[model samples]
Target: MLIRVLFAVLVVVSLVLGYVGLAEYLATSAQYAHRPLDLLYYDLQLFVINSAPVSNGGPYPWPLEVSRFLTPAVTAYAVVEAARLLFASEIARLRARRRARHIIVCGDSLAARTLASHLDAEHRVVRVESARSPAPLIAAGLPRAARLYACADETAANIATVLAASQVERKVHAPLEIHAHVSDPELGDALRDRGWREGLEVDFFSLDGVAAKQVIAAEQPDGERLVVIGLSAFGRALLLELARRRTEPVEVTVVDPDGEAVVAELAARHPFFAVACHVSVVPVYQPEPGVHLVFVCHDDEERALRDGLNAAATVDATRGTVIVRMAELAGVGEMMVQHGQEDRLRFVGVLDMASVYLSERITDSLARAVHRRYVRAQRALGQDVRSNPSLVDWDDLPDTLRDANRASAGDIERKLELVGCRLVPSLEAAAFTFEPEEVERLAVAEHERWVAERRADGWRYGSRRDNERKLHPDLRPWSDLGEAERQKDRNVVLALPEILADAGYRIVRR
Candidate 1:
């Protein structure tokens, strides 16, 4: 940007100098006496290196001499810049080789674009046309990149891209963090379950999953009675997130023409869906009284907006909020506000949500910090990475494990709400603490939340810990847990102040 500005300034300066120089030369010359317009025309020709200087066997005026050289230099620069633009990809590749710890985003998909946009402000972002192409990946400085995101439109393409990146990492013997976007829920789960290669650090994310988290965070809906008017991927994700956050089962009414099949598919994939939420399928949209929240998640933005507006009109302002899924913000919310529906209508854009997700995950966010704290605690108890798979660093942790940590971190707000407390940005570390009774109550709530999460993940109570069978004795109710197990939850409650403080937040009683 600065270079462009300087180039512009130089171009203008050369033009002005040429004009003034010509005017001065024409005024002082004895052999030539041209009109002002003629002089201006001659000055303009200097840029193409065809200007005739008005000199009668004597040295040209200083201004003319200066302009004569400056004009050609500016012309040369313009030529070079045009060539640079023509080969921008090659130039970017060459420049990328000199950059280290930069972010490399492959593909032109919306997810990739959003991630690049968010990271470019804080980090050097190198974009490549293809994720699976070795040439482009190498040109993008894959070996030098701090992180590589394979966000091609197709899941197979993204997978191939990451695999190619892994080969690059192996050849260079450099550690690279690889993130792949898997849109298919079942495929994503299967990949996560199969796990990445032992030595590679690969993370997978779904667009719907990230957007669902954003929607929930934005709305902060109570889990009393919710209506989801489309059992789309995003809708299912939202339900899963809600279940993960709430200890008690939420009553959700899914309104979709094919709600039965969609709900059945989700239930088959995740048995915990049935255990965590009391969901009822309905064929069509119906305005239900006493609903806490409603989400219009149709893939088509126009349909979503129309349905959302209708839902907003029927839903009582004081009772529920209606959310619409949009690809981008196009002033529909403002129009709703003009119609006096601002309090009830909200829009969640996919790009916006993806941007937030990338920003948080790419940095040392609160979620990563929570995982780090958990790892440290596990290590303090004499657990090693080999002995406990979850004892790995944030980068190496599986996506599911990472999601669990994120869910736990995300639940902080709900836990605060339980005790009439709230989190606000704070400058002081360890500046707040909960009372003894509050700690006990919160600890119990945390335990219940943990139980619900475990149950939702298909874990069951057993006499001993078994990761293979997904069984743990502590999976039972909080009351049934031993004092030692209860203390683990209490310790997390006790660490709330410091953890929140580290994330620049402080808990305050409402």
Candidate 2:
């Protein structure tokens, strides 16, 4: 009511001023020279008040005359407000560019909100564009994203824009990989296809869907590494089990939250051959049984493995016991039969078979599905036919290199016998290379390392425990040193390797 009355007063004042102006204009300047100009600006301002220009234009400077003709004083104040609002909006655009979070999302609003909610835990989100506010997305846990703009609506285009916004926001330091959520299966597939096109990997699975078979299959022969990603616990355990039982290697990268522990443990236990700059290459599985030895070398393959890419260099002085380092293995249980004597080969690895089945959801069938898919892709490429260069090309190397390579090759073929991993044509190198003596040496070295590490760990723990004991005089018993007990577990590290070495298997380094 107060605003309405003030508005009426402004109108009366404007009308009175107009009447005076009209008389003055008629008396002096013919019909007021500025009337036509002011009227044009007023009409344009009235029509385009909400339709603001990117560069210029705003509401009236003489708003009193244009609005209600309240008074010249009122008109001056209105003009100031219009100018201030216009500049303020421009500033908003600049600030948003600097600070806004950009999230590229797909699916219906609900799905977007769901995905947004998940992403919002760690990031701010920009709602691309829509009539309604993205409050649902914000509610779902997504950060507030007020400045929404898009160059295009296509998936690829949207990704580009999101990247742009990310750069503008300087998100590269604290990186956030794009998270896509598509509710519809068909749309999900489409999005995935586009993701690959954009050089991104996408993992997907229904919470309920399950595969049934578990056997690893033969491949067509593309020599490229086959990687299985986004595996569930069941899949990871299955894969790890297959690798454990195999004689060769299979590359696996599990992206499930539950599976990370398995991967970490595997990493800790596995013998790693190469610690290159960016690639922390660790072979996931080795076809050989009773041997998980990773050899580190300054140059040339360690004595256990011949040298270079020459598979021959991989042979151990002790013929039956084989060591594979920096290797991944698959298809071992059945392959073990080909080796002829189970007692001949000793299998040892950083692998814990229990880890394979640790995940409740992991199943043999999913593992087979992942492996079979790779085999199918390879077969489609016609990589088989002895042309699988991983075998022949390395096999065809000059005899000087090929001898050690041949020995290495024998080691691998022999390895298949150990684990029954037959599909992998013996690669002679890490396949069957490892000297038990060298492995023992590696193990001994490892034991020393464990001893040192454990000692250090013991000291660290002892200090803490002793400090606590000092704090509580009553609980501190003569031998009631819990810290000392904790330190004892450090010796557990060297125990396993020693037991394996004592078993008479060669424990070679990669």
Best by TM-score: 1
TM-score of 1: 0.63
lDDT of 2 by residue, 1-510 (tens): 785578668646565544444333333444334465553343333223321211143232343234333344455666776798789855644554455224444333433443345545544554444312333233322232322222222444444433443333222222222333222222433444443322222332211011101222222112223232223333333344344334444443332334455555545554331121011223332223222221221111142123112221232323322221111121252244256533332221111221121121112212222233333445777876365423332212333333432332233223323333332211112213333443334333333443444344332333343532332222232245355543333333223222222211222432
Poorest 10 consecutive residues of model 1 by lDDT?
168-177
RMSD list, candidates in order:
11.6, 27.2
Best by lDDT: 1
Worst 10 residues of 2 by lDDT: 206-215
TM-score of each: 0.63, 0.24
As a whole number from 0 to 100, the lDDT of residue 26 in candidate 1 is 77
Alpha-carbon lDDT, every model? 0.77, 0.32
TM-score of 2: 0.24
